[model samples]
Target: MTDGKVKARLKWACRRGMLELDVLFIPFVNEAYDDLSEQDKLTFERLLTCQDPELFAWFMGHEACEDTELNAMVQFILGRVKV
Candidate 1:
């Protein structure tokens, strides 16, 4: 897909129904996604496909990802928000 289309799709996917997930995801998509390596970009897309409760657990630091790729992506997103 074109970069514009990819971004638009990502923006739509990032809108999790839950406020907490939305708050975390939308900012990262807007501010950081374009700078990620191609692999990381794909990983982030995969992360978005995961169920919301699972995502919430990871982002809340209450659960950990067994997949290293996903673990790293979660950390990458967390890093951006940790001022």
Candidate 2:
């Protein structure tokens, strides 16, 4: 299969994961990251698919975005909400 095909599949899977992110996450976004019960946020971060500015924003309150963007997001969120 072509690179485009692989990328498309990845995007689709990421979208599906986004649904999970919303279901499992949205409620905790506005809360201070440090205030969260550590394990819950760690679990969400581990399971989340679209990890990106969108997710970070969603955590802070923004749009949901792509699959691989998660690593940067993990960093951003941790950095932004550090203790």
Candidate 3:
């Protein structure tokens, strides 16, 4: 797929039931997603598959993601937003 298509799909996937997640994800996909390596991009996609509550915990620093890759991605996003 084209890069725009990929980003468009990712932007859609970034939308969540939670507003907190939306603020984090939409901006990340818009401002940062293009800069990611292919591997990291895939990892981001994998992160999207995760449940919202788990993602919330991870993002909020209340819990850690057991998957190192996912954790890294989570941290990376948090770091970017300083949240």
Per-model CA lDDT versus the true structure? 0.93, 0.46, 0.95
Tens-digit per-residue lDDT, 1-83, candidate 3: 99889888999999999999999999999999989999999999999999999999999989999999999999999999975
**TM-score leader:** 1
lDDT of 1 by residue, 4-83 (tens): 99999999999997999999999998999999999999999999999999999999999999899999999988888997
Task: Tell me the alpha-carbon RMSD of every candidate.
Answer: 0.7, 13.2, 1.1
Which order, best to worst by lDDT? 3, 1, 2
- Which residue pairs clash within candidate 3? none
Evaluation by TM-score, superior candidate among 2 and 3: 3
In TM-score terms, candidate 3 sits at 0.96
TM-score of each: 0.96, 0.24, 0.96
Stretches of candidate 3 off by over 4 Å are none
Instruction: Show model 1 residue runs off by greater than 4 Å.
Output: none
User: Any idea what lDDT model 1 has?
Assistant: 0.93
* lDDT: the better of candidates 2 and 3: 3
lDDT of 2 by residue, 1-83 (tens): 67466334434434434453443344334444336455644544454544444564655544443434444454455564454
What is the clash tally of candidate 3? 0
